[model samples]
Target: MKNITDYSGKCVLVLGLAKSGYETARLLKKLGAVVTVNDGMDLTGNQDAEELITEGITIVDKEHPLSLLETNELIVKNPGIPYSVPILQEAEKKAIPIITEVELAYQINEGTTIAVTGTNGKTTVTSLIGDMFSHSSKKGLLSGNIGFVASKVAQEAEPEDTMITELSSFQLMGVQSYRPHIAVITNIYSAHLDYHGTQDEYVKAKMNIFKNQQSKDYLVFNDAQRELLELYTVNSKVIYFSTVRPTNGAYIKDDAIYFQEELICRLNQIVLPGKHNLENILASIAVCKLSGINNEAIIATLTSFEGIKHRTQYVTTIDGVKYYNDSKATNTLATKFALDAFNVPVHWLCGGLDRGNGFEDLDDHVKCVERMYIFGQTIPKLIDFAKKHDINYEMCHDVKDAVSKTAKFTKHGQVVLLSPACASWDQYPTYEVRGEDFIQQVKSME
Candidate 1:
């Protein structure tokens, strides 16, 4: 790793002890920084905290004390922690340089970075890029919001390695100089307004992915959002990706996918479905082409990649009814993509933590939804949507309840889709848990 700054004798506070926070603390301590970790949870038996204590890193668990801010020169916060947190707000007033682990990863990373961010398709595009690299001559280290801690991945990455990172707007907001060599924004839409407080703030947060990029660096953007994205003054070279029309980078023309003027693969050869997935594929192609990856590797990866889990992932077919888990659709736009993928009559399982956003945007997209299985905190909002569309509806306690109810009512050739277009915190702790519950429930029917 490149030693960009000397952290010796610097007092740094790591706010929130999640995986990223734990890794960040360890890395800071390793660099001789005076590290103090603060988490609201009581870490009395936490193995991670114990390990850190052994390394002489201070653990300030149980609560986030305001006093810690007075001593620390810098704050490394977990991405999930909002800036509205009192400690963070105070830090801002104190002129502390607050950042997420993504910034720290960039500061010390020896490898080239390819960061992907968007409302929906970033995870798929990031994973596809990494998968493409794995099948090719080059090496790509997959990390960031894709599950692996960015700082942890950066710690082991070599100079020649390509860091394919799936970044969220939450993570991007804290970045200062975290410029990726090849940045991709699959598509942008209004999301996470609960944390950001406004649509514009959320969009601005996602824009941080390419903020520090130079003219030599590449920004692979979704062509559909050209008007909104182009509003920002990007210093980097813009490479457009479109499933609709020809672009400067990757596009579909004459039934085949092309990067610039060179053919990558035929449209019929792609295994992943949906126009959203096509947008994801286009963005991946742009990044691969910018990285100089061979078309063979791209084609091989594209043809075989079924999809990542919990994002319109097919679980199984029971009695001719196909079940799909898309619990990652934590917003209306994401759910729209999930709904758009299926032409067959759908048992649309949705609703969760309402983020105060209505599902009216999904009015035109839910034409194929034969029935609505609603659950969680946003049940009333989803019920209103179902009523407006004159679709049959059922209220359930949670995802498992919804899945079981849908399974009984679903007819042959119909789809049982668990695409909750709201945050899962209303019931399950995470979307992953909700998705796993949906999968297990569907499997039990067999």
Candidate 2:
């Protein structure tokens, strides 16, 4: 802890009490802030809430009454809670300082931070960077969007520790002055438009990762996004990474990944699947090299590491048919990448919450998909795409159903892939839950 007394005697309201909310409330209370938690769900018999209540933290359940804002000087909200919420909109009117847990983490953190944000690949890159540091002399504390709440990890981290945080657009929008020492925007694309309401606003939210950075800090950007570079101005020292060609930062030269001029590893040595992962690898390499990690440690981590769970993760092969769980796709671009990774015929399982977007972008990418196993709220949307493309299709209730259907239809040398190109909220609580369901369903077949 920074021994910072800045928050002492302040009235702080923590909106939406999930894992992040629980952590944030406790942290604020320790800082001498009078904390009040507002959760839409009933917290009765909730052990986490009970612990907080015993500790003198208040809990207001069922509704977010705008009256709570009258007492709260600051609002630390769960990232998923929209600003369109009545209380949040009123807070904006009252000029209350609203921030996500990430901002609070940034304020009290003793560790140097390396934050990553993108449409895709951020989780993989963040995790890989953490692994790289673990293999090297330095320590990387993984936090934020990857699962471990940023505030919780920051409390334990020391000055020597490096925080490798994976931030989402939702989290970034709440930050006021959360500047990391090294920030990376792997690659931005159209995503979470339902939350942001526009592509430009979504891009703006992603841009917040580097907005507060100073001249001494580094911004590791995708060199391929010339349009993004042209449109957005980065004030920090820019280090570019590319899967295309040579760059000042990390780049592919002669089939090997390099940071500046030094070689890190060859393309063939990497075990992680998908060509899209090459961009992630390059971004990770840039961050590691910037942090003074050696090529040996970088190469070691890259070669030994398999893909992240539920992100194109290879499941067991049953009767010569391989299964992969990529429930974290949640968008068309990610699904396209997952589809492109396989050369063999794929029993493509997809569909989820209907964001009212067309799947025309994936029209050309479904060439290798032998059949489409559609499920969830977006089934009709996916079915329309399949019909238009003259592709084989089947409709299912959810991921488990899709997996079961896929197993029956898949043959020798073919693949069963659960890469839902939509949010998991329609059927499951999280993408992890949906992926676990798919995995368990596949296991039952054996």
Candidate 3:
């Protein structure tokens, strides 16, 4: 990594003025970089843009003026901005070094950094790792794809602190020098094909999480992931987490959660449920052990942890029906895992932007689904799946209607789960927003 202190007087162009880009711009500006931020939105006295403008950071909005590239030493691309964009192409022509904010955050961070990435459980493992650090009395700031930008946390990071981050394939694809002190891959699965162009490319993108790690750096991984086992190689010192076998890192055997040779806790003591969650817990335990957290603290955190807001979050129980908000399940594999977590009959609130991949992937799990409330652009595709699987289903306008409709069919002790096997881009901007909408709609039932 280049000297972060040398950013002063360097010309840095930040593309996309969303929270990620905007914060990167601020950090660059703080480092004395002559920074310019661009977004598709027109410049206005909108508080955030205006605040940056007043900070003497240039805010160019509404369009990407290619001419501005003449003097740039670096371009920081937001994870959301596609490389196919003309301005980015122009930057490539100019041979400008482009990287995500996390890369820059790593360049500037003095704290020990831990990054978690995978197709399904990044958020859960990331949150649990951060919680473990909190119980160990270490300062752990959680960030990245969970809504906190890494660089935003880096600005306040001290050497004594630790940074726990959740990374997505998009963020990892653009990373250049963003190696973590401790890196983790929960597991890899086919996801984000739309952005990655292909499964191989997506797998390669995720493997970037460990690209720069050295032998001294630690890699905690899911030993049970066949996809990971078949593809990708890790150079860092590896510690494995699994449910099937004894591992050097963490594992579960006969209901006991073990770290290395020691028993951390029993599986029944865990507050979070499901086999996938057991995988998440094992991964989190491995990370916590690497961070030197004691077993008692780890067990305490595990017993109290209810999981993050969206992924299988229990919203409420009304009229003997339990509603779980898993709006974060943005792909079929995630939805499948969510289903595997529950043995009870589920009235699933599913569907979203159709990726054309169809429902063949989730066919086996359809038997557990008592009723499917389909919604969004993928209604027809899911409805077809419902028919093929011979499961009862109904079409709904959105999450609100899905919740209301499911309520009528849900009897006591049944589950109304919002585990969309598709992304939320069709109806809402983010999964967080969609999950909030689902929570509000569920609350409306009373």
Name the runs in model 3 displaced over 4 angstroms: 1-3, 226-233
User: What global local distance difference test value does model 1 have?
Assistant: 0.90
CA-lDDT, candidates in order: 0.90, 0.92, 0.87
Q: lDDT tens string, model 2, 1-446?
A: 68789799999999999999999999999999999999999899999999999999999998999899989999999999999999999999999989999999999999899999999999999999999999999999999999999999999999999999999999999989899999999998888888999999999999999888889999999998957867777789999998878999999989988888887878899988778988998999999999999888898888899878999988899999998999999999999999999889999999998877779889789889899999989887888889898889998988877787775678999999998999999899999999999889988998
- TM-score for all predictions? 0.98, 0.99, 0.96
- Which 10-residue window of candidate 3 scores lowest in summed lDDT? 225-234
Could you tell me which residue pairs clash in candidate 2? none
Per-residue alpha-carbon lDDT of model 3 for 1-446, expressed as tens digits? 12367788999999888888878988888888998988888768678888898899888888998977987889899897878889989888989988888988888888899999998888999989888888887899998998788888887888889989999998998888788988889888788787778888988988899889898899888887645645556678888998999988898787798888798888778888777888888898998888888887898888999878888899889989998999999999889888887789999999898766677889788667899999999998888889998899999999999988886788998899999989999999999999999999989886
Model 2 TM: 0.99
Query: What pairs collide in candidate 3?
Result: none
Better of 2 and 3 by lDDT: 2
- Give the winner by lDDT: 1 or 2: 2
